[model samples]
Target: MQTILGANGQIGEELARYLHNTVTHDIRLVGRRPSAVNKTDELFSADLTDAEATDRAVAGSEIVYLTVGLPMDSAMWEERFPVMMENTIAAVRNHDAKLVFFDNTYMYPQTAAPQVEGKTPFEPRGRKAAVRARIATRLQEEMDAGRVEAVIVRAPEFYGPGKTQGLTNTTVFNRIKKGERPLVPVSADTQRSLIWTPDASRAMGLIGNTPDAYGQTWHLPIDQDRLTYREMIAIASEVTGRKIRFSTIPLAVFTLAGLFNAPAKEASELMPRYGVDNIFDTSKFAAHFPEFETTNYRDGISQLLSP
Candidate 1:
């Protein structure tokens, strides 16, 4: 049996679907309140921050996935993430279950550099990033020490159908769907590397089941044809059959706006990334999983705009 911790979010939900359809039906969904994605899934409501609760959630599982996501608040992340990670690692170790960790690029440096899985060193800039770096480092240390069998799957920002939330989805796709001008952050010319949510989940499912993929970090496969905001807007326009115009939010303006807005204030640390090219390299994944196919911008945008 495979178990998913924090199964309510988009990534967890999608991963459960993929595992059910392709890998196994004996899946356990664990969260504060997780609904089964498939009829065969067993639901166990538990807070991962609690050690006993987390151990109970992983007790009977052969594989465990850690895909928890918190709010954009730094203080909340600082307070909860480490505890959750510690509990999860302990539970997985105690249960003798292989772990699959779904990670993000938050710990990566905010720059135009290509984010290769092992080559890029952690240069986390803020509290959230620092927390991410710490947990990921702790996980790696465990992996390196052969204390647990695990693999890390990292993805860039998301853009996909259904309740998927991200900067691109909120600023661009949602706005275009609402017949409003899209808001581009910083520059429209800098290229972005976004992973389709399902693709990220599918890749993680594949990696988790593959024994050879353990003890390493992987950048989830993304469409090779990265696009800038200007190009992305053009694709959306074509897909929607309407010209879409967008206003670029400069760093100064975005930073100033954060002063009075809670969400914006929480996102200010990541705002620097929107200004530069985000080149997330997935050559390792491509090389390992030669048959995996990623969704492109035009097709992804078409799906997002579709009813």
Candidate 2:
């Protein structure tokens, strides 16, 4: 049986659906309230931060997918992730289960557009980035020591169905839906990387089953063409049959909001990144997971707009 650690998440639900609906694996979902998940036969609940509870949740599973939850803010990473990961790691080690960890490219330092896996030195600028580097290093150490077989599947900014109020649903999609152009800080021509959550799920599952994917950081398959953020917004607008009214702004607004608001406070420092074109190379994953096809941008937008 395959155990999905954060089975209540957007990607987690997709993973469960894929495993049950597509693959033959018997998925046991482990979360805070697994019984509440009406779709699954095996549901287990426990707080990964608690050792005994985590052990009980993970026992008897051969493959433990460790995509555990943690807050996005910098402070939470400092205080929460380490303890939860340690407990989960110990449990994975005890059970000798293969672990697959989800990751993002936060730790890589700010660089030019189209970032590859191996590039500039790992110099993170913010508290969250530093913490991500720490987590990656810790995972690598455990993997090197043969404590547990592991793989890190890195993804980019995610947007698909079931997204809550955040960058896409709140900022980008909302503005475009209202016929208002988003206040993009960067050039309208800056390229960006976006991950469809379902695609990420399929890629993760494929990697989990592939032995070569172990002990390596595999960039999940992303769009082949580097589309500008403006291009993305325009396509989303077109798909929704909504006329877009765009407003480009200077970096001053982000700085101003950072002074008074918390999420904005964090956003100001990363203005260069938002303004600069950011992209990732995932040809390696595509080569391996030949069936891992990403959804078309226009089609994905339509899916989100669907009732």
Q: Pick the candidate with the highest lDDT.
A: 1
Backbone clash pairs for candidate 1 read none
Candidate that would win on TM-score: 1
lDDT agreement with native, every candidate = 0.93, 0.74
- Which pairs of residues have clashing backbones in candidate 2? 181-245, 181-246
Cα deviation in Å at residue 270, candidate 2?
Answer: 3.8
Runs of candidate 1 with Cα error greater than 4 angstroms are: none
Model 1 worst lDDT run, 10 consecutive residues = 158-167
Each candidate structure's count of clashing pairs: 0, 2
Local accuracy of candidate 2 as per-residue lDDT tens digits, 253-279: 878888899988775665666667676
Q: Write the per-residue lDDT of candidate 1 for residues 1-307, one digit (tens) a residue.
A: 9999999999999999999999999999999999989999999999988999999999989999999999899999999999999999999999899999999999999999999999999999888899999999999999999999999999999988776879999999999999999999899999999989999899999999999999999999999889999999998888888888899999998789889997888888898998899999999999989999888888899989976
Q: How far is candidate 1 from the true structure (C-alpha RMSD, Å)?
A: 0.8
